[model samples]
Target: MKFTTYLRQGAPRLAVVDGGDLIDLNDADAQVPADMRAALRAGADLQAAGRRAIQAGKRQALDGTKLAPLVPEPGKIICLGLNYYDHAKEGGREKPDYPWFFFRAASSLVAHGEAGWLPRVSSRFDYEAELAVVIGTAVPRHTTQADALGHVFGYACFNDMSVRDYQKRTPQWTIGKNFDRTGGFGPVLVTADELAPGATGLRIQSRLNGQVMQDANTDDMIFSVAETIALLAEVLTLEPGDVIVMGTPAGVGQARTPPVWMKAGDTIEIDIERVGLLSNPIANEAA
Candidate 1:
């Protein structure tokens, strides 16, 4: 089952997409009617109930309405860096022996179809199209690959936009990655059962202002989704509502000859096979 969060009158609510229209789960108390976050915290029971309710609902077609991030406000946003060999080589860095990780504050998340703000904080804004994993259960240190997947709730599309100038200057990538309204995530949360952890043949791509920037398949990932979960579980406790953004592929703006940074009015679209396209307009940050 696919789940989504959408804005209705400036408030975020959990919803399920049938064909086109979104089914307001909050309105129908037939199942676990809590919000997406709350339901995630409640674990499997609520997820099952929500799925059942969504399947039973009368399909409503949404005609080009805005979609909020699948997991709008996760407790944690763990991101992997240079997990792709091509991306690592492009950055003039050797492939890491282990998964290099960083964190993006929950405040940076922007929903699908929402406008992405180009902050005055930096001028080298860039885009990264990635596949993100959403955690479903609490997992402490030293978990096996099998144990790792047992903690996953679902998967979603993640666009980890960056500011190249700020990122390269500092050893830590948080500043460039955690800029407000830059991380685009959404379309919907596809349940773990709906997708095989590493077997899904998903193709991820990004287009900036009608020009294709990045194109790659999940199979090319240096670290598979299951491996990432297992590796992270060895150090940090993975909890429900925590999201992991697997690193992106090559063809980013910073890597281009004449760095094609985003400008106000530019449109960025990321498409992941199986997971629908997430498109957002670029706008100047508010004064």
Candidate 2:
């Protein structure tokens, strides 16, 4: 089942998407949490409740609804760098034996239909189309790859926007990546069961102002979802509501001839086959 988190009276509400309508799950069953993170923490029982709501609850028009970031506030937002071969080559880097992990603060996330801030201090912002995984269960430390899939709840499309100037100021990427509202996170969350095992072999792309900037397949990823999780679990527990953004493919604005940074008024889109499309307008960060 597809799930969406949208705003009602400026507060987030969890709903199940059904044929152009949204069924508010919490309204259908008070037992279900109104937040996606909370609901997922509630476990499989909440999934059953969502299914029942799709059949018996009232439906609300999905159009004109204001969306919220899929998780709103993920405890840990881990990202991979140079996980795609061509992407590494574009930046004059080698395919590494281990995943290059980075973290993004919760304040950086911007929901679909909202604007992605282009910091006034820099115009070197770039777009990265990536597949983001939403962890559903708490993974025990040292879990195996075989058991990692059980911890995933769903998948979503993500635009891992970058502030190139700040990113290059230091070797660590956290400062540049944590610019408020730079990460475009969701429109809908497609459960893991809805796609192929590990979400492999799917096409993912990024478009800027209607032109395709990046086009590649998930098959190009150096590390698959299960492998990444297993590796992560070996060090720390993967808790529910945590997000893992698989790295992007080659065609980013930074690697292009003469560069192509996003400016105010440009719109960026991330389309991940079978997951969903996430679109966000570019806007200058308010002074």
- Choose the strongest candidate by TM-score: 2
On the 0 to 100 scale, the lDDT of residue 205 in model 1 is 92
lDDT of 2 by residue, 1-287 (tens): 78989998999898999879999999999988899888877774556877899889999888778999988989899999999999999999999899999999889999999999989899999999999999998999999999999888889999999999999999988888989999999999998988988899899999999999999999999999999999998899988899999999999999989999999999999999988899999999988
Query: Pairing residues by index, what is the TM-score of model 2?
Result: 0.98
Per-residue C-alpha lDDT of model 1 across residues 161-269, encoded as one tens digit per residue: 8988888778888888988899999888777887766535789899998889998888878888888888887788888888899999888898889888988899999
**What total of clashing residue pairs does each candidate reach?**
4, 0
Q: Which prediction has the highest lDDT against the true structure?
A: 2
All-Cα superposition RMSD per candidate: 1.8, 0.9
Ten-residue segment with the worst summed lDDT in candidate 2? 41-50
Which residue pairs clash within candidate 2? none
Clashes of 2: 0
What is the Cα-based TM-score of model 1?
Answer: 0.93
Instruction: Assess the local accuracy of residue 48 in candidate 1 as a C-alpha lDDT between 0 and 100.
Output: 51
Taken over the whole model, the C-alpha lDDT of each candidate is 0.81, 0.92
